[model samples]
Target: MTLVRDIREDDAQDWRRLWAGYNDFYEASVPTEVTEYTWRRLLDPTSSLIGRIAEIDARVVGFSVSVLHDSSWTSSPICYLEDLFVDPSLRSGGVGRALIQDLVDLGRARGWSRLYWHTQANNQRARRLYDAFVEADDFVRYRLTL
Candidate 1:
């Protein structure tokens, strides 16, 4: 059986391990400072960023980070699933689906107008699952780093 729960301070070891894997999957080099700050933000009750962990057989196997933001087009907030990752060994075992669905349920209960996320174009494995649950849009995303 699998359990999805909010992240706790004691989850550092597990979270760092899974988070490192997640960063590697995206070929991202996340600095330690950023990771520490993110950890603090996730645990801060007033922060809009939240995190959850998925455990199976008492071992943490995956995690997700989401942010709630106000939307100009609607009164309800928008939920953006900023990050999602599962252990490579645990793929296709319903962990990913469970994490996403948990957030979907949360969004529904919180009156969020939308729950969305973005993944690398080549992340076919995750895209497949996301495609199944959410509609695809033709919008293109561009970012400018300062």
Candidate 2:
């Protein structure tokens, strides 16, 4: 069975491996400095970023990061799934699904109004899995780099 739990200090190497795979899947590259900063933030209790790693037989094979944010539309908070990654070899083995379910449970426990995420339109496989939960939003996303 796959076990899911909060990311621990000793899992840095495995986290980096999965993080590299995640970046490769999106064809994006993050600087080592930025990655180190993020790693530190995730482990910091004061940081808003919360991460969970999935382990199968004590080896980390997947991870997810989520953040809780205040929403004007509701008095309670909403949970945004910032990043989720499962080793390519472990895809379709319920690791991703379990991570997502864990996030949902967390949101429910915290009284979050919504749990949402976005994926590239070209990611048909992920879309297929996501579709089983909720339909895509009609709005488009735009980013402005500072």
RMSD, every candidate, angstroms: 0.8, 0.9
Write model 2 residue lDDT over 2-92, tens digit each, in one string: 8989999999999999999999999999999999999998899888888899999998999998887888999998888999999999899
TM-score of each: 0.97, 0.96
Report the lDDT tens digits of candidate 1 across residue range 1-146.
77999999999999999999989888899999999999999889899998999999989999999999998899999999999999999999999999999999888987999998998788888889999897679999999999
Task: Score candidate 2 by TM-score against the native.
Answer: 0.96
What lDDT is reached at residue 55 by model 1?
Answer: 97
**Clash numbers, per candidate:** 0, 0
Clashing pairs in 2: none
Report lDDT (CA) for all predictions.
0.92, 0.92
